[model samples]
Target: MKKIAILNGPNLDRLGKREPEIYGHTTLADLEASLRAEFAATTSLDFFQSNHEGALIDKIAALADAKFDGIVINGAALTHTSVALRDALAGAHLPTVEVHISNIYKREEFRHTSLTAPVSLAVISGLGLEGYFAAVRFLLKR
Candidate 1:
């Protein structure tokens, strides 16, 4: 089975409550349960969520050290701001898929750019929670 890491950053812990209109009503736990149930037979998944940038970077480094097959990440607000996070992903050299619940293009101008997308194998945006499913599927297929 493929070993995959799902890393969520920043305000994503507020998934259901932060902006139901935008992120939908699925809590992070609910989403994880759904993914686990869907892919239980084919993949081993490890999940981590952190509001701190350094913690996230540390997790990425650990994933690299552990030889994870791929990564599915929803960098949340950090997608638009964190060069360090981008560098960590790039340096890790893992096959990564970046996911976004909201269409960054449809939001503020600052949200239009993603520092992490360039390092990811593909990006899923504007599809709400389905973006996470799509990202995991992409990594699995690879």
Candidate 2:
């Protein structure tokens, strides 16, 4: 079975409460369950989350052995600051899609720039949880 890794970072663990207006009222687990149900018959997914940068990197490094065919990542706050995460994704060399539930560009100036965008195959934003599902579909087509 083909496997995909859905990696989330930082404050995203508290999605439902963190930024209810931007991230929606859905918790991360709730969104995961929906994603699983949506992709259940199509592919297997390994879901992981971490508030620590090293832990996220560690999880991604472990996937270097062809364990995951693709990756959908919501790097959260790290998307703007973490070169380590960007480096890990590039080193993995997998088809990667960066997801963002909110429209970063329309918000604060600080959220406008993404350090990881240069290394990603695609960036899906402003569509909330549906953006993640879109990334999954893109992988399916690939």
TM-score of 1: 0.98
**Can you tell me which runs of candidate 1 are displaced by over 4 Å?**
none
The candidate that wins on lDDT is 1
lDDT measured at residue 101 in model 2 versus the true structure, 0 to 100: 94
**Tens-digit lDDT track of model 1 for 19-122:** 79888888999999999998899999999999999999999999999999999999988999999999999999999999988898999999999999999999
Query: In candidate 1, what residue range of length 10 has the lowest lDDT sum?
Result: 128-137
Candidate 1: RMSD over Cα atoms?
0.6
Q: Which stretches of candidate 2 lie over 4 Å from their true place?
A: none
lDDT over C-alpha atoms for residue 85 of model 1: 99
Alpha-carbon local distance difference test for all models: 0.93, 0.91
